[model samples]
Target chain A: MLEVKNLHVTVDGQPILKGLDLSVGAGEVHAIMGPNGSGKSTLAYVLAGREGYEVTEGSILYQGRDLLDLSPEERARDGIFLAFQYPVEIPGVGTNSFLKTAVNAVRKHRGERELDAMEFMKLMREKRDLLGVNEEMLRRSLNVGFSGGEKKRTEILQMALLDPKLAVLDETDSGLDIDALKIVAEGVNALRSPDRAMVLITHYQRLLNYIVPDKVHVLAAGCIAKSGGKELAHQLEKEGYGDLAGKTGAAA
Target chain B: MASETTTGLPYADRFAAIAATLPGQSVPWLRELREDSFARFAQLGLPTPRVEQWKYTNLHPLTKAGFEPAVVNGQGRGQIKALQPLSSLLPAEEPAHRLVFVNGLFRRDLSEIGALPEGVRLDGLGEALASEAESLAPMLGRAVRSGDNALLALNTALMADGCILRIGRGVSIDAPIHLVFVGAAEETALAFHPRNLIVAERDSRAVIFESHVASNGGVYWSNPVTEVTVEDGAEIQHYKFQDESLDAFHIALTEVEIGERGRYHSFVMTSGGRLSRQEIRAVLDGKGAECRLTGGYLARGKQHVDNTTEIVHAKPHTTSKEVYKGVLDEQGRAVFQGKIIVEKDAQKSDGHQLNRTLLLSDRAEIDTKPELEIYADDVKCSHGATAGELEESALFYLRARGIDETAARRMLIEAFLGDLGEDLASATVKAALQRRVSNWLAAI
Candidate 1:
């Protein structure tokens, strides 16, 4: 469902992702793990089409189409979702209204009839129950004064509502407590199905315990150092990236 | 009466022709007041950029426009031909006492005044002056002296028609009083000065909604001065919307004085006019008095909108709060000057003021000045101002959720302005103003 071929990205004229290649098939979940400043978030932002992440070389293909050619909103409407590592605190915008607008926009782009207020509320109630998100949180301004756990849970809620074909999770578990991590993982696990792919970018293997991934790759020096099955995550978690540091010619 | 020198008077020739036809000419006190005001205005002339208060805004365009007085054009009174489409800001179904004015003239045919409460005087200033001129003598211009501001003097000298509302002691009016002032296009550019006086007696309560709108395709100037007196224990919520034509100039000033334990709150939104300035000066005169001034403005194209406010705390334990937000796009320009003063006797006074603006384009500009002068050591007074473009992260967050770019920007701007209306007491006026903001966003 997603393919990145020798992708080299730069931000502020400094190269961050150099010759990075990765591929994920439909119904597969891949975990990309790296230490601090190893270009983990850079890869996520590049896939999400964020500005300032200039692609200096190579290309990204999603479902056999050039993903880099589409704008951020176009990528979103075409079933690509990016859960921001740090969700912006937007005061004055009601979370419920924002969610409704996003849901309607995506639905319209998919050739589906827009849901009325009543229908949308019904759907929101169901999703809220599944993710343990209460009505009060949605009534307040978007992520303003929200706790770290609440923000992460809301990101999951948005993912559930949009139901994107390819979901990019950027540090979703970085600030979450154990309870919030489980809730977020449960929400993500429920959405796992055929014809849908998800990329989990994390600095720790703690999240892999809740929702196991089919593959794991260690990113170092702006490129993937090793790719293996799920067991590689446990190995890296136990031994750290000390052994891979010599190959990448950088201190871990 | 045209002077020979350049500084003779800004509008001396024009004021000379319309002085005889002004309202309240027969009353001796009113006549002297007009003459004195005209002389003061002649001395001050037009405010130049050299003046400290008028540094950011230039009145050169207004003077060069060569606008004649509307009263002399015979358009202040009688029936107007194109009055059908000019509607009140309030909904038709809402119960309101409405007074309509066209070209600064009271239009009895267009005004819809319901049955006012007992002892409440709701009528035109022209009518009030014609009958029982003594009743309005002490209250008119009591909040602000004409000698303090040149534009106030100009308005006082050539005032023709406006709304005169007087609420008796302890009277509480449930319905809002609506004042609609429309400037209709004519053969030549016209200027009109409307004088408004609102007096809420001790313990009285009322709300007033004032709207200044202009008909399409007119180069007119609407110079209005409104004075409000909130007596001891009285409460008044004064709301105004200035939406003149895109080719027009709007210069308005409102002065309010609150007595012991009185409450005065106001919100003025400006989204129209080629060049406009809305200045408000409020004073808390007695102990425990309160004042809140909040508003939002939207400007685009070559429009220039200015909001200048001053709140003075004169008595101990008085409180004042102000918040103003604006959005400017294209080559639009805006100015916000907020001054807060805590006098020596105003010990324990609490005052806070905040002004934030969003500039949507590189060419859009905003000049904000927040002045805080506190002579009392025990008072808590602070002010802040901020101007910046929209947050790119916020915009990208909204668009990442499938919302289009335009929709995202609108949502953020709406949120920026909508937060200011959360603390408003009147829901009806809040909704009306919100609708106006939405309409302005749609146009931009």
Candidate 2:
């Protein structure tokens, strides 16, 4: 469902992602494990089409479409959702209203009918119930003064509402306690289906323990140094990137 | 359009033409007031960018056109018009007592004054100037000075007919008194000034709803000055809605005086007019009096709107709070100036002010100033101002779900203006303001 070919991205004229390549098919959950400054978040931003991130080389094809050529909104409507590591606090905009608008924007792009207020509320209630997010969060201005756990849950609620084709969870485990980590994992697990895919980016193996990954790719420097099964995550969590530094030595 | 001038123009002399049409009332106080106000008007002259209050908002586009006073080619008053909001959001039908004005003339036909309780007098300014000089002449110009602003000076210099509502002591006006001001369009560029005085007597309760709407006001100028007095223990709610024509210019000055234990609430909404300035000066004259002020502006196109307020706390235990938010789209410009003062001996006085702006386009602009002065040691006062574009992350969050950018933006703006709406004393007025905001946001 998602493909990145020689993706070289720069932010503020500084090289962040250098010729990075990765691929994930439908129903497959691939975890990109990297240490601090390994371009994990950069890869996620480049894939989701954030502004100011210059993709100088190669292509990102999502479901066989040129992702780089699409606008941020267009990429979103095309079923690319990014669960931000730090979800933005949008004052005055209600959480429910934001979700409904996004849902309809994507729905209209996909030739679907827009949901009215009542219909949208019902859909939102279902997601809130599934994700265990409180209704108070939905009523308040979008994420204004929202707690870390509430913000994370709000992000997951949006993901559940949007149901994008290629979901990129950018370190959803950060800032979340053990309980929040489990809830986020549960939300990700519920989204697993045959026709959809997700890319989980994390620094530790703790989130992997909850949402098992089908494949694990070790991102070193700016490129993927190795790709293996979920066992690679456990190994890295045990020995850290120190083991990769020695193994990929001279050749890297 | 006439050439723009800094000093004086032909329109300044047109005041005599308007004065000639008003009822002949040359009482000593009236003559003194007219002469003094005329002198003041001539002294300050037409407002220019040199004045601090009129700094960001220029009156050249308005004064450049030598329009006859709206009083000259005036159309008689007709039926009152509904607001721009959904009808369900407003109170059904006009209230019990209403005073109507057309081209600055009092229209008793469309007005309803019988709904007021006994001992209440809701009369026209012209009639009051002629008959009740004993009751109000002493306090008419005591509230505001036109010298501070040229348009206000213009209003005083050209004052013709308006409204003067008085509630008797210990009386409570259940139905709010509505004052409607509508300007008529004519061949020549016209100017208009409608002055009003609202007095809620001691221990009485009254509400004022001042609605200003003009259809093709002929690219003319509308200058209005309204003074409100809340006697000891009275409660007052004042609402001002301006939906003037795009070519018209609107300058409104409102001064409010609160007595001991009295409460005053004022909300201003600016949704129309080519260039509009709303000046609010609220004075807490007695101890334990409270004033709550809130307003919002929804501007689009190239319209320029300004909301300026000056609050004074002259007594102990007086509390004042002001909140204003606005959404500017296209090339619209919004300005906010707030000045708060706590006088000596006004111990335990508390005051706060906040002004925020949301710019929807790169071309849109906002200038905000929040000033505070405290001479009392026990006073607590503060003010805040902020202006910026819409939050991009919020937009992306909404669009990613399916809401089009337009709808998302509308929702955000509505949310931004929510708290201010909820502060309205009347539910209908709040909903009406919300509807206007929603319509403007939808169009934007």
| lDDT winner | 1
The clash count for each model shown is 0, 16
RMSD after Cα superposition, model 2: 3.1
Clashing pairs in 1: none
Docking class of 2: medium
Give me the candidate number with maximum DockQ.
1
Model 1 chain A poorest 10 in a row by lDDT: A243-252
**Scored by CA lDDT, what does every candidate get?**
0.88, 0.80
User: RMSD of candidate 1 to the true fold?
Assistant: 1.9
Determine the iRMS, in angstroms, of model 2.
Answer: 2.3
Local accuracy of candidate 1 as per-residue lDDT tens digits, A180-237: 9999999999999988999999999999999899999999989999999999999999
**In order, what DockQ does each candidate have?**
0.88, 0.53
Task: List residue ranges in candidate 2 displaced over 4 A.
Answer: A116-122, A243-252, B1-7, B14-18, B72-96, B145-153
lDDT digits (tens) for residues B1-444 of candidate 1 = 443133334456666567877777788898888989887877787788888888888877887676777776344532365555544266766788888898898888888898888979888897777677798889887998436588898889888888899999999998999998888867677888899999999999998988888766688888999999999999999888888889999999999999999999999888889999999999999999999999889999999998998999999999999999999999999999999999999999999999999999999999999999999999888888899999999999998999998999999999989877888888887888788878878865
